[model samples]
Target: MDILDILLSASFWAAAIRIASPLIFATLGELICERAGVLNLGIEGIMVAGAFSGWIAVWAGLPLWGGVAVAMLTGMAFGLLHATLSVPFGLSQHVVGIGLTLLATSLTFYTYRVVLPEVSSPPKIEAFQPYEIPLLADLPLIGPALFSQTPLTYAAFLLAAICAYTLYRTPVGLAVRAAGENPSAVAAQGLSVTAIRMGAVITGSGFMAVGGAFLTLSAFDSFFFDMVNGRGWICIALVVFGAWRPGKAVLGAILFAAFDALQIRLQQTAIGALVPYQLFLMLPYILSILALVVMSRRAEVPAALMVPFNKGER
Candidate 1:
């Protein structure tokens, strides 16, 4: 039709990519942790924690990159806590993660009220600007539609590819995989399972933090109570959908995000009056359950996931 129609049509895909951005980052982060035989169910909490930390950092005059760095550090701290509980104290991984999530929820709310007690309106931070490559951004149809996205979107794509390569190609990746599969066997070969686990947890946290930072600093330009909005759980579901493969997880993230974007657009269209918004909101979870049901028979989960390892006991 006209230029307005073209923009509307293209906006659908663009919005999908935008929604996918955070999910991809968070899902890939969860994939890394899970692949290393650790089930950190705290992904959602860590994400919300990072969202607030990053937002506060930005509000305090730190550069946007600084905010991201602080968010990563916050995630790392939580990872350290998680590792301590599950790895050393022999606590239940699921329990520890649930506890962490609760702690994060409390922490985010406390900080929000304490810091902005009198502010009646929500506060915002400056979001990251899109950086478009001139010639490429000008290309026909797909080019501008894809290349004109926020920087975080490109970073998510690159990180997914890199994570795939790291998990399947490199020696370090091999060590991590081996540790997850058979810790005693790996340790007998002189590799430190604990060390590998620590590294994976930390790295995973960094990725998760970036996912949170992207939400406040790029997607929404502000932090609100529970701003992550269960995205962390969505990321965990994505890992199952992707079978813990980085590339597949990213694709799943895109699909989940597409449903989310579609729901938002539908809310604004004439069809909104005919359909229940709750059904649209529930689409991602429904897809996730369907994926789990279909893939359970075929998916290969890490053999030792969530099992605590003790050198002497082995």
Candidate 2:
């Protein structure tokens, strides 16, 4: 295809959507938890666990939707674990999160080895099909590229919108913000700070898990070692970059995803064959660090973020 043809191709946008979906999901998830004053460093582990769990569900003859469900449930479980350790026990969230990541890494490897002893090549499955909007898909340049995408991609966008609304527009949202800002004040007002934060943590984890499932079930249709590959950590940085706002986080995710998509495209071109592929692979990390440095000046983190709230205080 010519330059114009390739630029306008459905495939280019498809690649962008594919790259954006997981990041959008994960970043929005982190937004939810972080907005509620909890930092989940275990996100990497939770995502890895979700990827393995979702793949196992598919391998067990469950539908992709079923796998998604399993992944979400697994995420909720991890969220609860993080909450229990950090909130009630008053432990450092970073330490708990890191421990959880180490645990998840071990669990994923153990399960994979046990379930697929002879499988040298990673097992693959049928990925989810993209949904095309009737009239929108037929539009000019950006139509097919943007309108025709997988259900998870659409869901990622929808989740971003919904999270932004709920976090800023709803009563529960107010409570969540209060819990994150001043749990004692919220408690004096007869609201249960613990409950609100716990709910946020669990729900946030579910979102992250869905992102992981998107990677395994929709994007690749297979599980590989460290398949999440620090995308979970990237999500954390995106949350910071977005200043704990879901809409901004989604925008950040898409930006990062676009860079990633560009890297992949470069890898497949003639120029890609001439250069060292690892250099291209490093672009995402370098860009992420640069983005983080730039965005930090603008970020507005919650006042109580990363601080354990004592139930008996005040």
Candidate 3:
């Protein structure tokens, strides 16, 4: 089919939503971190650790949700390490984040080898099944695309809504935003900027881990090395694309996912025969870069983002 036909196809949209699910989770997690003035670059390794932890937990016979919990807790542990050095100790956020990534990635690989030393291939497990909401799934184009997705996909969207509400509508949300924008003001009001930043990093990291779990427990049945494949980095950019707002970040994720879905479909059409496969592979990133450039031009970053705050210091 042609490009226009492919764009209109319900199946294509469904694929886009599925592809966007993991991104939605990670982007929201990153958004939360940045909103609280911390840049957790450990996201990539955190996602890798999360994917492995969740899969291994399930392989060890925990229920699917239990595996998800394991993954989230694993991520939070790494996040705590990140927070301890960067928040209270006032270390370089960049160095701490990168160090955490390397540490998490290496630990995950070591654990995998130790657990399955003799196994040549990764094992598979039963994964989550799609759940279709009755009436909503019956709709024409929007139904299958939105309503017919795995439980994790639905949870991703729900979490986005919750993030938006918490960030804009609640007192705690105000404190979090204040911590990122003007820590002095937060301190004047008797809130602990260090505590707020640390909590945000830990909570955000948990969400990021759940994103990784989505891959093993929902998108696929088995885990493999490099399965996360830099999606974590993409999530960082998506936060910028969405200007750190949960709602906008979600849209950015969906837009990127659509471009990705389109590229895959185009590779199957007559155009795939005319162009190199590498070009198709690059299509999503190229388009996403252009979109990011346009959208980020007007994005207003939090004033205190990445600025280390020490109590009683201006």
Candidate 4:
């Protein structure tokens, strides 16, 4: 198809949203952690763990919801691990995060092989199907793109709103922000910075797990080692790319998903042959670098991000 044809297709937009679904969940989760002054790089492994945990739940004859619940619980466990290491013990966030990622990824793959063994084909599970919204599905272009989505897709959109409200409204939200900006001040005010950070990290992880679960449970069938690909890393970048705002993060995610969708569709066309498809695949990452450079100056990250707080120390 031609350029205009590609841009105008409702199917294309719908595909973009689908591609972005999981990323949004992960992004919001990370956003919460960062806003609370803790950077959880354990995100990649958490997602893999979630993907593995969710798949295992379904394999055991549990429903999709049950699998999701399992994934969230698994994610929370990891989050608590990160919190215990970084928040309570005052460990380096970078080391803890990277270490967790490696640990989680290794644990997942080893378990997968041990449980199922190497086979010609991996096990498959029933996945979620697209559910059309009755009234809006018929609208010319926008309706099909926005309204006609799986329940997960709609929930993702709703999540953006929920995140926006929680961070911008609510007393607990203020405490989280304060903990990020100035923990000593929060501590002086009788708010426990440790408690807020731990809560944010643990709760945020559940959302990240949900994102991973979406991959095996909805985006595609069966669990594959690399199914998560670099989506976790991309979610991390989008947090900065979105300037830590939910609406902006969603926008950044959609933009990345659009390019991702374009590259996939282009790879199938005659134009794809004229240029290397690998180059198109690089668009998202390339934009990530360029966007960070351009957006970094204006980006407002939490003041204490990646810094550990020791209650007894000044």
Candidate 2 — number of clashing residue pairs?
0
Ranking by TM-score: 3, 4, 1, 2
User: Where is model 2 poorest over a 10-residue stretch in terms of lDDT?
Assistant: 1-10
Candidate 2 regions exceeding 4 Å error are: 1-10, 267-276
**Model 3: per-residue lDDT, tens digit, 1-314?**
89999999999999999999989988998899899999999999899999999999999999999999999999999989998999999899899989998999999999999999988789998998999999999999989999999999999999999999999999888999999999999999999999999999999999999899899999999888889999999999999999889998999999999999999999999989999999998988898899999999999898899999999986
Greater TM-score among 2 and 4 belongs to 4
All candidates' lDDT scores? 0.82, 0.83, 0.93, 0.89
Predicted candidate 2 versus true structure: per-residue lDDT over 1-314, tens digit per residue: 34455556677767877788988888887778877889988888888888888888988899888988999998889889988887777798889989988987788889888988898698787778888888998888567777888887888888888988888899999888888888888888987777888888889888888888898988888898877988998998888888778877877787787677677777777778799999888887789789888987877778888877877775
Top-lDDT candidate index: 3
Candidate 3 Cα deviation (angstroms), residue 15? 0.6
Clashes of each: 0, 0, 0, 0
Distance from true position, residue 288, model 2, in Å? 3.2
Clash pairs detected, candidate 1: none
State the lDDT at 181 in candidate 4: 87
How would you encode candidate 4's per-residue C-alpha lDDT over 31-99 as one tens digit per residue?
999999999899999999999999888987999889889999999999999999989887999999999
The TM-score leader among the candidates is: 3
Regarding TM-score, does 1 or 4 come out ahead? 4
How well does candidate 1 score on lDDT at residue 214? Answer: 88
Candidate 1 C-alpha lDDT tens digits along 176-228 = 88777888887898887888887887788778878987899888888888678
TM-score of each: 0.92, 0.91, 0.98, 0.96
Model 1 scores what on Cα lDDT? 0.82
